[model samples]
Each structure stands twice: as structure tokens, then as C-alpha cells.
Target chain A: MEMTMCGIVGLFLKKEDLRPRLGDLLTDMLITMTDRGPDSAGIAIYGDEAPGLKMTIQSETPDETFAGLGDALTVAVGAPVPLRVADTHAVLILPEGTEAAARAFMTEKGIRVMGTGHAMEIFKEVGLPKDVAARFGVRGMGGSHGIGHTRMATESAVTTLGAHPFSTGDDQCLVHNGSLSNHNHLRRSLTQKGFPPSTENDTEVAACYISSRLAEGASLGEALEGTLDDLDGFFTFVVGTKTGFGVVRDPIACKPAVMAETDDYVAFGSEYRAFANLPGIEDARVWEPEPATVYFWER
Target chain B: MRTIDMATTPLRDLNSTLQAAAASGEGQWEIVNPKGSHAVAVGLDGPIAVTIKGSTGYYCAGMNKAAKIHVTGSVGPGVAENMMSGHVIIEGDASQYAGATGHGGLLVIKGNASSRCGISMKGIDIVVHGNIGHMSAFMAQSGNLVVLGDAGDALGDSLYEARLFVRGSVKSLGADCVEKEMRPEHVEILRDLLDRSGAEAKPEEFKRYGSARQLYNFHVDNAGAY
Candidate 1:
């Protein structure tokens, strides 16, 4: 009933050279949660891609299609973005100035786009770490702070959309483990709050719920704490932004989350192996987050 | 017969020696003073008896095939992860996720075992003489998990294809989990398993816990709850 492993990797690099290490470090971190998820893998990387904000474009296939209007998307985004079309995914990296227009244009074009501070690249095809890593080319260009998902495919169908690191309409994304018993109610509430719901996933509802609160000028910590009062369920989620990260466990705390902190960086995961995988942290002091406690760290 | 003093031997050298001993078809092997070392007797597949004199670390007898392993002290996470077949007897407390995803084997923990014991177990018999932590036998595919002591909260959460026996109080049941009537057949099985493990408790004292068949196959009715 409960998902065991969840992970988040954030690094404030002493030097720019340390950024590349995030790939192998994230690979090691994500692989440790293999028991939690064996179906697909995805990562959201935020590095030197663009100084300004980036937008997330989500699309599906068959009935909800968007691949037909590639030319319109290119002009609207104002960039000849590489469109990696899977059965369900079609993405374009919009520049900073065009983010709002791109969001609106994609909305009219029937493509769901949200602005996120972190550049998210999600790849989900069945394979081992090497094959998955090759698809996103994460072998060389790992970023400073990234979150990964390895899903066991319990609640929702195993698809790239169900893959985590769900982005809000702004520069925030979230990855979650554990089921939310009250996702339906939360989704209904979020829709009433003027937030458009995309996936049928409860995690997406949670992402939007938090994002809507943040849009009301709430701090990340305030939004998280506020959700605890309203949202009900068992979930341990790690939400990431460009300059900050936050982790919150459900009130019941059925899920597991361990954190290791050093002077330079912070790492948290459902298991100890993720912390063990980070370099320059051969002896990072690790501890588990208490139940109902929300932790926030800003770089 | 063979004996390796782990106090002076590294795990790499000692594991090789134990493998050699098992390949030699030695009836008995002893690891004296195996203090907090990890991966002891892992993947050993032979008709051999191993006795680890002290505490061990994670995956102590992981993926074991035929050998019978005895740990004299506490064991860390995943004491027998994915073990194929064998007997692992723990004389002391066990840490988290003990016997996780094991396919086949008999895990006898004389002392308490921590959470997620026998999680996703396919075909195994785990006998815990002391209290068990939360989520014991979670999502177990097929196996017999016998607990002689009180079980912590959420026993047998989302359980499947597993038979569970607990002699003491159960804190709570997980999603789709329930308490079943302990039939005479279950009592017989428990008796036999306890006899084999040399446990003193009687089978009649134990209660049975298992899946309620609610969240077995994902129906819309049981969505989000699991």
C-alpha cells in the first residue's frame, strides 16, 4: 500500500566542475530506489540551460494529440526547439521572454505548457540505467539540483506522464512517492481554484495544489504547511525550484525519507544508498525526517 | 568441517573460503567472531551449515541457495534478500527490510525483526520468534510468515498470496489486510514450522493475518486507498 523509496539531490557546487558529477551521482541515487520502481526512470535537471525561466510542455497521443501542429509551436515558442516525440511526450524549451506566450500558445494549440525555473527532461522507455541515461544524454550534462523517479506503477498506468517531477505553471516541480487517499477531493478543489488539471495522477493534483498556493504569494514552506491542513493522505514528496528545495511527509508518516547534510550540500532519499552514492560525502551525517515535519533548504 | 575466524579475515577472503568450504561439501562451517561485517554467506549454494558467531551487516545471507546460516547477533537490512532456497537463523534482532523480495527460503529470526520483513516474498517461510516491525509481509506474493511475538502496526499491508501467523497482539492492519480464522491446517503448518525452528510457543496461541481480497486487483472502488 505504501511506496518505500523516494529521492532528491541538491548540490551547491563549490566550483562549476562539480556540476558534471551530478549525473553519476543522480544515477547512483536513482538506482538505489530500483526496488521502489522498476518500470521507468525520469530526471529533472536545472543547470546553466538558461538564466531566466523555462516552461514545461506536456502532451499525450491518440485522442489528445499535439504532434500535428509542430510548425505553429515552433513559431509561437520563437525557437526551433527539438521536439522529441514519443507515444505521449512532445516538448520544446521556450526561451525566457516567450515563456508566458508559449504557455498561452501551447494552450491554444492543445499542448500543456507550464513555466518552471528548472529545465525538466523526462525520458521513459523500458531499459536499464545505461539505456535510460542514453536517451536523455544525462551521462555528461547533469545539473546542480535534480529529482529522479523510478516508479513501480501502482496507482496509475506506467507512462512517461505518470513519471514524476511534476511542474507547476511556474518555476517549481515535485516528485512524490506513496498514494494519496484524498487525491480526488484535492483535484476537485484545485480545478475550482482556476488550475487546469492534466494527468489523472494524484501526484499531479498535489503539484498543482501546492503551486496554486504559491501563486497566491505564499512561500514554499507556507504552501507546504498549508497543504497539510487541507490535503489528506499518505505521501512523501520532494518539491524543487531553481534556488530552493522542500520535502514534506504526510501527517501519518507511513512513508520513509532520510536526509544527509554537509556544509556544502544536502541529499535526501528513501534509502541510505542515495546518500552513499554522492561523492565528496563519503561520511555525510544522515538522519530520517520525522513524521509531519516539513523541511526546507535554500541555496 | 571448516572454520574461518572473521576477526582476522576480510569479507572478500572469508566469503571465498566459505564458498570453497561449501564446494568441498563440508558438513559444517563456522565463522567465529563475525562482527558487524556485511554480506556474510551471501549466495552460498550448498548443503553446508554456517554459524556466524557475532553481529553482521546488510544482506548477510542474501540469495542463499542450500546452506543453513546462523547469525549469533543482530543483522542489518535485507538479511536474506532474494534468497533462492536455504535456512537463515538469526539469534538476535534484525534491522529493516529483512528478507526483502526473497523468492524461496526459510528465515528463522529468534529475536525481533524490523520492518518490511518478507516484503514481496514469493515463496519462503519466515518464522520470527519475537516482535516484528511495521509492514511485515507487505505485498508478499506467496510465503508463510510466522510471528511468535506482537506485530507492529500495519501488518500484511497490500498482502498477496502469503499466509501469516502471529501469536501476540497486532497493532493494525494495512490496506486490504485482515485477520483470518486460523484453521486446523494452519495450526498444523505452524506447529511443524515452529518445531523446525525450535520455538517453544504452541500453534494454538497464534492468530492468522492475511489479505482481505479487497485491494488485490485494482478496482475503481479501491483506488487511492491502496
Candidate 2:
């Protein structure tokens, strides 16, 4: 019951002009779903990419922890690490191939790595979803695609890290709206396969599972299909890759999902009510996706 | 004619006024800017005619009685759920479980209906112009489900007495549900239902499917299969 009550929202833009409005559009959809999950909220935005690796890290004490952090990291990695702070989370654009070195450096310095990719930046916190989005200024961010989650927190404690939109692979992440009964068993197998979950949250296990499959040369659609056969329990997973987003639901489809596709964008929500305010929504082709089927759109 | 703009009036207020109109008796209402709000025009109990402008969220016209509700756009899940008596028409597609567990009503969907359409319906008459999803009419007790298009996997599993009619192909029939002989009475019923629902198909194009009555009573020998 805890897992089945979260709200998931995704928007993948097909037009470049709509890219700047992705975060603003998604924030409205996410806040409208505050009734579904109020324990925690998280958003993963695939914004414009530069020629470097971007890593988002979080800290409880930001001013003290972030001051002089970039210069020190730049010197340690022998490359410039430009950091942009957004409240509790900070995005660091590091030089190419410095992700592994920077991750280890952050671990030693006791900073939690939220996510790392060429474009993706994850921001999450434990509070009302509306407040969380405002604190991170999510509406001001821009991207081509993004996924957001408002968690009810049935299985784990309501903390900053125990939110949805778990990222395990580079330029990849996942947000879920249901619980996995077989997560404990799957976690063991996934850990052995070198995609160990960083959190006790069952959703992270599924995220790690996808990351592992993608690492083994599986496409996003194939990785989603694998979940239907291997994973147990109810889920509606909306995954994010470098270029696009994918959606898949468990065979039972206990969790509800609705999708809308227009010429400009493809939108996914836990319910149609989430899409009430989108532009050109009336002209979109709206329908509920079938169970155990994989739907993905790429640029 | 009364016009209620949902953009200004809250959903709770909209529903209350619609429901309160039952005491004032029959009237015509037009709701604009519905914007996919949940439970709009629900619990209405008069001979009112409500025409909603846009798509609606969950449970629109739920538990309705005597009112005629029409939506110009698609509907979310559980539309007309547990309806006692009314006429509900959707101009576009319907989400999962359209007319679920309705006791008595006439539901017409001009477009497709998703999974579990008319599940557990008691006495509702449902007609879909397009396809229905898997596990439809599951454990239904009594009703009539008519689909002009195909039905997904496991059409009417564990059914009892509810008559199923399909003009197109059915992927597979559930346990204890089989294609029965379409008699003259069924053809007449189908003809009237199609006419009333504004479906274009002929009654002879349909095939009837219903319960074998094997799963009705729990017998010691039929515990596993039934």
C-alpha cells in the first residue's frame, strides 16, 4: 500500500522551443500531485549538456561544505570543476573522464553524490512537494526531458535521500510508483552484478537493475521489458536515459498511469489530472498505456 | 440553462450544486473548463442533463441516478462507477473499468475502453464503439457488455449470468465463458442497444458469450477449476 500511492510525472519535449519550459511545466504537474505523496519529492532534469561530466551532490550543511570545495577538487583532479549550488544540492561540471576520481574524492570528503551525468541533475528533499520544488527552484530549470516523484514513504524513513528518482547509471535514472515485494532478493543479485543499491529504498534496487542491464548493452526498452519477467510486485517505472524517457508497468498494473502525446511533447502522469495545465493538452492524443508493454520516445 | 465554469468554482462546489439540483428537479447544465478534475458532477440524483466541455478525471458521474451526463472528451478511470441508474455518454475514449460495478444504467463510449471495462457490473448496459482491454467483465454477476471492437486477453473471467456480445474478434475467452448461440431475443436486444447507443454495426455481426454456470456454486469436486 505504501508503494502504490506515489505520484510519477514525466515530460519529454520534442520541440527545442519547449525545452526551456520543461521544469516549469513539470513543477506544476508535480505540485498538483501533492495529495498522492507528501513525505518526499524529487525531480531529475535532463538539461542542456556541455562537453563535461556534471555531478550533483548534496549536503546538510551547504555553505560550510561547498565553500572552497570546487577549487580543491579542481586541483586534486588536475582539471577545472565548476560548481553551481542550488540550496542543499550542488551541480559540479567536471572535465571529461574525471567522474570516477571526483566520486572517490567526494566520498572521502563525506559528501553524498546524488547523481552524475552529462545533463541530468537530481534535487530531492523531505517535505511537502510544493515546498521542495520551490526550495530547489525547480521551475526555473530547463531540460529536454525530466521525471519527478512525490513519495509517501511507506517502506523507508522520510529523509532527503529516501526519495524517488534514483540514479545509478551515467545519464540514466528511474522513478517508481509502486512497491517491490521481491526487492531484497533482487538487490542481492544486482549487487553481485556490480550495481549495488546505495539506499535501502526498494526503488533504488530497480534503478540499479536497469543501470546494470544498460551497462551490459541493453537498450532502455529492453531493460524495461526485463523488469516484467524478473521483478515481482506492482510498479509503474518511468526511466530516463541520455536522449529520451521510457515507461513500463507491471503486468497487474495496480498502479495507474496516463500518457499524452502531442507534436511538441510526450507527457506521463499518475493520473490525467496531473496534465490539466499543460499547453496544447486538449489537442494531445491521451490514452492509458497497456500493462507489460514498453513505450519509449527518443530524440 | 445554467453554465458553471470550473476554473472559478471549486470542484467540491461544482459537485454539490449538481447534486443539490436533484432537489430542485430536472434542469440543463453546462460545465466549462473541467480541465480533468476528479469526481466532477458525481452523486447527481435528478433528471438533469449535464454536458461537460472537456475531459474528466476519476469517477465522473459516479453513483449517478436519473441524470444524463455527456462529456465531449475522454474520461479517466472508474467513470460511472457504481452507478445506480442514469444515462452516461462519452464522446471519446474511456480509461480502465468504465461502468465498473454499476447496478443499473446505460453507458455508451464512442471510443475505446481500457482494461476491466464493466468489471463486476451488476445490471448496467455498456456499449463500447472500440476495443476493450484485458480481464474485462471479471467476476461480473449480471449485466450486458457489448463491444463493437476486439477484446483483449481473458475476456470475462469467472463470470456469472452477465451476457457478453462482441461484433469483432475476441482474443480469448476466460474460464467457463464460451461463445453461445445468438438467438433471436439476443439479436433484438443487441439491435436496440446498438441503436440507442448510436453504434453503426448490425446485430447479426455480433456473437454472444456468457457463463457456463459451472463456477456458480462451490462444490467439493470443483475447488481448483471453478
Candidate 3:
């Protein structure tokens, strides 16, 4: 028994009908890869919202008690402040120019926040699938694409906030398997450039690093492909964007990832058994995506 | 003989389908795309022969009664554990603990095998063509391990009554276990075993090995190390 890595399941639907009815599709897929994750599970459903930003707070605090972490976000452009506060997280709608101030505030409070565009929303917690969903208010939630995480906890603490799909700014959420051997070096680089990390987990550093690259005009696929040359370790990752989904594998090919594609949807997991029960897949046309390759699906 | 393609079929549905075919008095079964399955030919009570086309997860033919199982790809842990009768042939590699605690059966691997090949065997015949991993026959009470290739360290650590034969180098022999002369009787026995496994190698290409008899009843010298 080697060290267990994270289980990441991604779903991309061609139609809106497949998006809303994704609970069963995702549940069946995740259960097949249960061996990869036995500690916690979560989902981030990207829905149709104004082109804006979404932030997820991963720290020790009562931020989730704030009702409607969903409704508080807005597509404004000026100042940034929390519209509501939840149990251990909060929902804030920041104006465009206030991105600097908002990040500064969260950093000062020792609260880790990653923001993606409004196309993606992330909800995660510790426990099984049903428990995580019930705790995170996933029902009736609509999104075009979603990414999920089930944790086995090889290194990081098993905290609710630590469950993935983590964000970098808004609409950009990431889930990862395998450890980053060069995290300290990467973290030093980011913190020197005013991006002080909140958590000791290496995944946070990876999120920020990719976010930084994309902000510098590097496409999602390019940034992920760039990671293979720069990062040193075994890892397989999937990131959800508003327009599409991105996937990558480390150079070593130590971790496993299986992907299944059809006109209706494209799904991937750490094991072949995970995608065996997709609803519309009448034939088993699954393939193990080669290591060091990045896949981009925009629909 | 009957052939079934299990490419996209659910495992439960395939199991029931095979059972139905057997109930109808089928003598031979061939399965393809058997990706990572456990207990494939379990509890069969007839003169049946089955060949699995691909790799399996665990316990491929556990507690087999009277059926022969042949696997085309590698097998995970416990290939024929606790098998009662019949044969299991592997065309490719095998993982750890193959033929573990088996009472009676014949298991043959055409390729390499991992650790603990014949652990706690009451009675069985396990033949390997390629190299074996560490702890090949641990705590084996009674069985026969014929290895055409090299064996890893600790071939037999604790032995009650088990016979082992190796053609290549022994990395490290376990406590109270040493090499012995291969008599003409043993050579003839190995020749017959090789022919049964469909191996084309000559009988003289293999050598015989077993316990050094110092461990038959443990003494102070053998007791401290093991």
C-alpha cells in the first residue's frame, strides 16, 4: 500500500439538461473511485452568472454561517467587501478595480482565499459525498461544468476547508493528486511577488502559481504544460474554467488518470472503474490519457 | 466451448450470464476484456475449463472445485488462494501472495511472479517460468514450487513440509533452508510438471531445492534467527 493520492472527477456537459441533473451522474462516477479517497468529498458546479469573480475561503473561522454564499456575489466594479458571512466562509462580490484591496484584506486576516471567474463555484467539506453536499448546499445549484475532490489525506490535515476544488481568484478552481516536491521554492517565488500563502499545503502554491501564469497571458493549457517542465514530483490535476475544463499529468506518470469522451460529456477520474457507470455512455469508450499531456475542453 | 466478450458488460450481469451458461452444461468458457475482476471462476463443481483474456484484481479463482482457469494477463494478489482442485494458468506476470494458503490445486505462471507464492500451502503444485519476488514460499506447510527462473531473497523462511525447486540463482536462503541433491526421481517429477504447464523448456534446465532438515524441529541455533 503506497501513499494514497487525491481522487478528482470532472464532468463537462454539452447540454444544460445534463448540467442540472448532474448529481446522479457525478455520484455514480465518484463512488467508483472510492479507493482513491475515503476521507472527504466536494463539488464545484459552474453555472451561468455574470462575468465576475468567486472566492473560496480556506482557513479556521466561521465563514460558512453566512447564508447564501451564492447570492452575495455580484458583477460590480469599484470597492470590495463581504456582503454576507457564513459559518466558516463568506460570499463577497468585488468590483473589478478592488481586486487588489480584497486580496490584501483576506491576506491580512490570515484567511486563505482563491478566486476564479463567476463561471465556476466551489463547495467542499469533510465526510462522505452525501454529507459534503448537504453541508455545502449543492442541491438545486446549477452549473455547466463541475469538478470534485475526494481526499485520502496523505500529507495535509483533513479539514473541511482543505477539501478541493481550490480557487486562485474566481471562476478558476483546481483539484490535484500527488505531492509537489518544489512547493517551498514556488511558495517563496509567489510570496516575494506579494502573494503570501495562507496554508502550508503545497496545493495552494500550485493554484497560485498557475493563476499567476494565466494572469500573465498564458492559456490554461500552456500553464499546465509549462508545469511539467518546471514542477518536480508525481501529480495529476484537473482545473475547471467557465468556458472549459483543463487536465494535466506530471512527467513521472506515477499517478493514474482515466478519461472518457462523448458528444454529451467528457469525464475523467483516477480509475477506469469510476467512469464505468456514466449515464449516457452506452459503450465503454474510456482511455487513459497519456502522462504529461494537457486536455482542454471548452463547451 | 463458449466464448463471451465482456467489453462493456457489467460484472454482475456477466457473472450471472456465465452461471447460466454453465448450468446448461457448457464444458469450456473463454472470457475477453476481464479487466480487474475478483473471484472469477469460484465454486465451480463441474469439469469446466475457462480462460480469462486480461488482467484480474484479486482472488481470481479462489476455492475452485473442479474447473481450470487460464489468465492471459497479469493477476493481482492471491491468484488461487484456498483452491480445492483443478488448475490455474497465467500467461503473464503475477502480483504478491499467489497461491496463498491453498489446499489442493495446480497453478502455473508462464511469466514472472511476486512475493509469497506458496504461503501456508496444505497441498498444491505451483510452477513458475520466470523470476519470483521476495518471500516466495513463506510458512508453507506442504506444496511444490518449481521455478524455471531465478528466485528472490528468502525463498522459504519457515517450512513445515514444502518442496521447492529453482533453476537459477537463489538470492538469499531462509533459516534452516539449504540446497540438496536433485535425484533422478526428482528430475522425472519436474519433467512431468513442466509438460503440464505447456512450457517448452527442457527438464534438465531446472534444478531442485528444499529445506536443510535443521528446521524440521526448531533448535536454539535455528530459533534465534528465524
What is the DockQ for all candidates, taken in turn?
0.05, 0.80, 0.06
- Global lDDT of model 3: 0.71
The candidate that wins on DockQ is 2
| Model 1 CA deviation exceeding 4 Å by range | A1-17, A49-51, A56-74, A77-97, A107-115, A118-129, B1-226
Better of 1 and 3 by lDDT: 1
Least lDDT summed over 10 consecutive residues: which range in candidate 2 chain B? Answer: B217-226
Model 2 agreement with the true structure over A1-299: per-residue lDDT tens digits: 24758899999999999988999999999998898999889999999896798899999999999999999998878899899999999999989878889988998999999998998999999999999999999999999999999988766678888887899988898999888889899989999999999777888999999999999999888999999999998899999999979999988776889999999999999988889999999999998898899999988
Model 1, range B62-177, lDDT digits (tens) per residue? 88888899987667678989988889999877767788888887999987886788889998899998888777888998889999998877889999979989989998888888
Candidate 3 lDDT over B1-226, as tens digits, reads 6777777777667667666654565478888766555566665655578888866666787777667889877676678888787898988766667888888879998877766778787788899988887777888888788898889778888766788888889988877667777888888878888888877777677766677666577587766687
What docking tier does model 2 reach? high
TM-score of each: 0.58, 0.97, 0.58
- Best of the two (1, 2) by lDDT: 2
Ranking by lDDT: 2, 1, 3
**Ordered list by DockQ, greatest first:** 2, 3, 1
Give me the iRMSD of candidate 2, please.
0.9
Write down the DockQ of candidate 1: 0.05
